[model samples]
Target: MDTTVANTGTEGKTWGGGNQPLKSSYGKMMMWFFIVSDALTFSGFLAAYGFSRFKFIGSWPIADEVFTHVPFFHGNYPMIYVAFMTFVLIMSSVTMVLAVDAGHHMKKTKVTWYMFLTIIGGLIFVGSQAWEWGTFIKGEYGAVQTNGGNILQFGKYETVDGNAVFKRVAVSDIAIDAHGERVEHERKNGLWFVDESALPAYTVDEVYNGLKANSDVLVRTQIINDEGEKTVLSREESLNQIKNNGKLVVQGANLQVNEYGTSLFADFFFFITGFHGFHVFSGVVINIIIFFNVILGTYERRGSYEMVEKVGLYWHFVDLVWVFVFTFFYLV
Candidate 1:
């Protein structure tokens, strides 16, 4: 054992390889340690995420129904768009692995080309993430209720005869704080600076009153149906009950959302997904820097390109995080 150790030292000195500490370099070792800790950190996050999911298992909304918009299609398509996003990210992971394989063989040309492709893949994935975020923020179906608070879910029913199929209003539709004025937003004299559409449909005061009167309707971030068509119910009856002859007031960013789905749902969905998307963006930036270094022969001049390996590790770890995210956020 002593002779083997002595021989290793002698060989290292002969090769002027002192920089390669313990058969590796300071940077590579540090990167490995960082990766280990980061892996644990990511694991903790995923664990917490899973716990939250389980805690809210019954109330948790289905991801597919929530984000079902395609690139060019209308609001009817389900999460097919997001599924494409997952595929893009997974494909980028493959490209990154190939780039690392080229690096292992010291094939500089192949490494550069593969790395370039990997960067492109990462960029594309990030772009797709951005589009998804936009769709989520914009929102989709408008919610029921004049207060615009709470989601109204629907359930299917069969007539007692067993031959008739029908859908009833899932929840009461009472829009709260809807955009524009309940009364006309026109000037006292009838001249208007802004169009009537620009005004809020309902004021906050009216929304509060409506919510107080309704007891059967509940609110939520996303509304779904068990088997029948989920119709947006009107708060007309509830409003009429509360004020005898009062007109229902409703309108903007209220409890109701436009395209992506429910407004609150858009809020949480965008927040979580955007944060993850940012990580991918940063990873791509780092990859670009490493790609340039590989192109300029910086490592070749130094006699060792361990930096490439270090960055490769980071890339793979990013890919690893996405694996669990994809499963939980989409498939599950």
Candidate 2:
């Protein structure tokens, strides 16, 4: 006996075997699934970062001191460029909303213009992020790694507005190069198969000597005191620390060493921000494809602008993720 159920006009029912579920297209449902999964992934990454930072809360790099850079400017302007990038990305989301609204109205020209603006905003944000990565890796104020893997920075206390402010002193500004013959250890020249890393700008001895010569500059340890400022050593202690505990001259940030505090901070920064940057770049490419499709009247011929709405969903998700990332990494 065959047990087949007959269709009784259940195509538009809630549990009916239809393409649209919950009044949403299959494409939109899939997009929502992807966004939810991606959000979980980001949450896991951020949670891991939070735990690690808590483990090393006192030694973690300060965001303001680390990101005090602006394009083509020399002065220390904390969070200026990052703020600009966030604003641009948020505005792009606004433009995406306008594009989706225009698509609903079947206004192809308005949709095209809005999409174009969104693409431009994404490009600018991506470019700015790349520059920020470069600046982060290059580093600003150089430091020395101690024997116990602690970072020892050179700085001085200055009175600004009746408050004491710590000013960073670059290693190059203090250390006098000894003109020593430093050579890269190539695989061919060395006995081991692996090659060593490049030499730093100054030697430990040069840094020590420079520290001794500079009386005003003091040594700032990685430890944060009760007042939330890095513990600064006196002149005698500074000279003794450089003479006895200094291990190597560290310049920039990498997988191994970080001039700005712990290497773990740099690791998370690169991984999380790089992942978000990749998303932004992919969104930009997808928007370009959709923009051309709009110009060619693809959605217009289909009598629906749902494609624009779908892409807008993705763009808005990307923007929202960046907001969380910015808060976690920069503000918090």
Model 2, backbone clash pairs (residues 3+ apart or across chains), number: 0
Clashes of 1: 37
Cα-based TM-score, every candidate: 0.64, 0.92
lDDT (Cα atoms) of all candidates against the true structure: 0.57, 0.88
Off by over 4 Å in 2: 1-17, 187-194
Q: What tens-digit string does per-residue lDDT give for candidate 1 at 1-332?
A: 11112112324453444344566554555677887887787666667667766664444556765567788777556667766777777787777777776665667888788778878878888888877766665444333332333333322345767774433222224434444444555655467565464433444345445455544443332334464223433445444433442223222122334322344444444555555677788888998998998899776565444566667777777777777777767777
- Point to the candidate with the largest TM-score: 2
Estimate the lDDT of model 2.
0.88
